[model samples]
Target: MEKQVNAKPGTKQKKRIKMNMLIDNFQLATLTLPTIILLGIFAYWPMFGIILAFKDFKVPKGIIGSPWVDPIYKNFQFFFESQDAWRVTRNTLGLNLLFIVISTVAGVIFALIMFEVKKAKYVKIYQTASIIPSFLSWVVVGYMVYSLLAPQGGLLNKIIIGLGGEGIQWYTQPQYWPLILLISNVWHGVGIGSIIYYAALMGVDTELFEAAQMDGANKLRRVFHVSLPQLVPIITIMTLLAIGGIFRADFGLFYNVTRNQGALYSTTDVIDTYVYRALMNQGNIGMSSAVGLFQSLVCFVVLLTSNFIVTKVEPENALF
Candidate 1:
């Protein structure tokens, strides 16, 4: 057998080896072709439209035919100089930060709590209940919220009148919207976020928990020492990803839930809603494109900075 193996391969062996490699490559290419085509059509193709941001766009002139801004900064200048800039920026960042914090903490807590439930049936039921809201469109959620907050016939107002108190106009009041939006966002988002943490928790090595128990660690101690530490990487990755969209608000949530009420713009207006309003009211595609480009640039910078910080603090957890 050794002598036979040492013998030089004939032309058939060489051709078969080459044929197998060719077939493997063909299979890989075939599997990936659709994805490549999709990316080329949707992602890479639309990226060329980014040039519209720097052009003084006119529908008659088309994208390529449109004249460039006298100063490339003109579109950006219009946005930054507008009175809506500060308010929208503040609303977007503040609400997003609040949502991130609440979601992260609530998600982790829920996951840890779920981890302790011995019955898989109860865990599944709880998870399903929590996650169902995530599947609901913001339009549906908006109506649900409206029913609970409508001034004349809302559930809250009914309860208030029953208690000898005046019914609150929840939508008209800007002061109450921060709380409302926070609650709305958390309620809609926490389930999906918790599912992420739950998945991370599932991957924790049982041996770590066993070792902790061997050291006289109780359940809470084991979770704190073993479970939490194991989860830091996943948590860091999720936070970094969230940071990329810090400047972008959920349009459906902000627009639909607020009913686009002018009175609520002070609290609910965000970069996304502002862009939509600009496009609708002014029909300035360039301005809208500029806003979009600005959002993309800011998100990119923030994501990079956040990733850098994570790398410095905890290299292992950093998403490269």
Candidate 2:
């Protein structure tokens, strides 16, 4: 006896999808062969060094022949017992948090203001000018800042002195560094962030704005009722990404801005700078790796928790 047939939707579409996937896989294999080999050679092959986190890494013997340890790891103990650990960690997290907040807010506001700017010529000019700061090397920026902010014969100081005001020791004053770092971070980074947010803003449907306008909604009401609501998903995801770096400060911004002053270490030092100083001062490879591992674990936890909260509140906005 002949069996009755059951019709299914999208069987043809599924067949096409499978065929396309096979074609894509074949093309990717051709494109990625060299890259995969390179990563295997230089990237994955070097992962063996990760064992140094467990071993007592000696410079002469190197990772391959290094001795491993178990009872109360000295690398970690040495790091913890030292006072620099807390200072560096606190500064790192604090400065990064400041950057995250200031950059996020300023970026969004800049994007909003850019959106309000009508002329395309002026918009592009302003946008270009804003993002130019982001492209400069921190070293160049540091010198430029020093040229402007230096106390002895510096531009700002010269102006202050011209006005008969006292010349402040900009580098020595720890109280001012935090504000300077915050402003510098925002100024350097906000443009790139604003561009991201502006791109997201452009994706917003114009019909919503039109509908709001018809209901006697002014620009302010339209923004609050239409624009901000549309922007929530983009905002949340961007914020989550920033939070992932809460434990990782921009090394250049913090270290360069402070001019690497030992006296400013309390206010200006961060995880990256601390690791740098540790390597410079202590020359301990194993301990540096351990500190890195600790930072990664904390950032991982923060990212996961933020994602979890986002999923509960707005599943659409959750990155995962």
lDDT of 2 by residue, 154-229 (tens): 9989999999999988888887888888888887888888998888878988898899999999988987898788
Q: Kindly state the number of residue pairs that clash in model 1.
A: 0
Q: Write out the backbone clash pairs for model 2.
A: none
Q: After superposing candidate 2 on the true structure, give the runs of residues whose Cα lies further than 4 Å from its correct spot.
A: 1-20, 24-47, 70-72
Identify the candidate with maximal lDDT: 1
Which residue pairs clash in candidate 1? none
Candidate 1 matches the true fold with a TM-score of 0.90
Steric overlap count per candidate: 0, 0
- TM-score list, all predictions: 0.90, 0.89
lDDT of candidate 1 over 74-101, digit per residue (tens): 9899999999999999999999999888
Q: 56 in model 2: Cα distance from truth in Å?
A: 1.5
